[model samples]
Target: MTLRPIRLLAGAALSLALASCGTTYSMPGIADETNSRASTMFAEAKTAAPRSPISESAGVNRFARVARRIEPVARQLCETELAQGKAVDCDVKLELDREMQQRNAYFTYAEAGNRSPVIRFSVPLLQDTGNDDEVAFIMGHEYGHLIGRHIQKGQQQAIAGALILGVITAAASAQGGGYYDQTAVENSMELGAMVGQRAYSQTYELESDMLGTRISHAAGYDPVKGAQFFARDEAARSGGGQLSFWGTHPPDEKRMAMVLATMEQIQGQQALTRKASQ
Candidate 1:
């Protein structure tokens, strides 16, 4: 579910998968750099997040730890939401690729943009996990996509993404194609096109967090683990939480408060149910 260089590579195909969306943010001379990023992310996902020996690079192994915490929550969301009555299949991975710099994470829905999606974490931006909440939260966020059927929802986002890239491309054409303008086009593609979709994207994120809490709590991981990821005070003003405005994310404190509030709600319901059982 890792995003690739082509998505951000200035030109790629998205007609087949959610991965087909070409990047408007890629500058002319930097396609190779983006490819390196794509390669690195794929390598990391194959090695780190799997349950076996991480034969790939080990620098980003921390994200894999978080991905492990994510599996149960992801499966539960799919089972409950889709009524599949079976384990939800998912692959959660992380990478240090910079092409996905604008995307702290994403739900790459399916092969035909139809099946269960994989969750990609931007390794460049991810903090190493110690308590394991960030992974749970991220998994929850992606599982929320499954609950909300974000693959189908992503069709709408695709239009928004494409349009964003189109406008920037037009702007670049008008500006005589200087390297500076080209770079502007790329940023515009990400910030203008992809960023505008932040409202729904952020909504998906928060919804995932809520659902993740339920899944994690049920599975025995502290639901608060996911929320604590958003508690970093420094990054929140610039970056915290997901599926919201593009200034990075919600304020760290605000996200933590929201997660805690959600937890309390979940706990209250669980307590009520237990009392009734008694």
Candidate 2:
């Protein structure tokens, strides 16, 4: 009986997956960068809050530690996606910008032709978050981007958008037998870039969340508590648990639901494994 439901769900998912794969676009650039932006961030950034009472330094250190631990696990997760016996030849560098320049964390490929990934944390993010679990989840999510190569995919999408728009602009100019406005070409490229970056952005966020749930749990952190950070942030901003979609990110409530659902799936799998072992 249980197998019947599982099969039905799997079939439905496969059908949807097939339908979505009908159209495709490609990006034109090296998917990774070797440049390091850490120095600039450290040199010019400053914290937004006072340091004495909150011990912002300590918070920053803790953030670094959590990020360091999560990086290797994320790499291992990436490895699982590769063909048998393949490996990634790089380390993940964890850094913090104490200046609180932005309450954000992100992953990027190292410049200089090295594939080593870098994860940076903003001090304000560490200070603003309530606990280690939240930080871990956030780190894992960023790490997911690195492992999943979303940066490269995003660049590809952007380039494809620009090329398409450029072609259209050129064709239009040719039809008029006159020079295309330089400003018009630039504007089209900018618009294409904007669209490219945002294409399937919400889907990417959800994918990262799915990976983050597993990564955080594997690292011994509770994703449920980590997900509370979203709830808290939403409540603070909107004054209620209002659900609304944001560009480039899913709504807090939807993300929360994804996390919880992922947790449930993990638990279910573990239970099945245990039963089989008995």
Candidate 3:
């Protein structure tokens, strides 16, 4: 459901305490779709697809290595470019034994969404062949979440949804003299919330892809080459029948296009030794 539906439910009471609440989605159809577009885009650039990385416990170390390489650059980029002159006050911690056995690296603010915002990566490298570029790119992807401010924005969206929902319900009951159509009210509220949420959450990914590109470039890594990892994987998994490339992420083709466009802009700056001040 979209976030707009949630907000409508909250209705006009958002002035109050709005605080509250709240892929690859790579099932069968998902992968095949990614493969077609991601594959073509990468192939045109002569970028070879990568085999699936190992998925065992041994792989975490590999993921960690990649995260380490990119963390410095990602943090620096945020502080210098995205943070708007705010200092980045956070830490990166590695684990040799995680009880939950999570397969992915994650980003968590040290402040826990309160004050000192921090983004942490918590996965080891792939257990398969240790491709640092791919691993770093993976790390870059998680870090991309923070650069995009998905964390805080996500919280705000949730609260907005909840606030709208509560207000809508309360107001409907009051206006209807304690008699309201439950189904109609529910359907309307849900639809509105979904629209609002999607607009805020889903659309930011392309911009994040662009931001990630700038990050990879600044870190002294090959953003173009690093992107090849996603390009190759997206195409292979997308197989040949998937429909939307952005089943979860930015569509493979769209992401490729954005990254390329961003590359052109940055390379021009590099040639001129241009430095970003904000």
For model 1, the run of ten residues with the poorest summed lDDT? 21-30
| Candidate that would win on TM-score | 2
- State the lDDT of candidate 3 residue by residue for 41-142, as single tens digits: 766644554346466655666655555667787777666533464334434443333433223345555546555544333332244233555455545655
Best by lDDT: 2
Steric overlap count per candidate: 9, 8, 47
Clashing pairs in 1: 7-23, 13-20, 14-20, 25-186, 95-123, 133-225, 201-243, 202-243, 202-244
- lDDT comparison, 1 vs 3, better candidate: 3
Worst 10 residues of 2 by lDDT: 27-36
Give one digit per residue, the lDDT tens place, for model 1 in 1-278: 11233245333323323442322111122244444543443333324321222222342565666555557556655666446543344443333444553325666644654454566665433543334555556556556666665445556455556555755465456556444455655665565445434436555555555666666666566866555444433333123323322234553333344455566677678899999999
In order, candidate lDDTs are 0.49, 0.61, 0.52
lDDT of 3: 0.52
- Stretches of model 3 off by over 4 angstroms after superposition: 1-64, 81-89, 92-103, 109-125, 128-130, 169-196, 233-250, 274-278
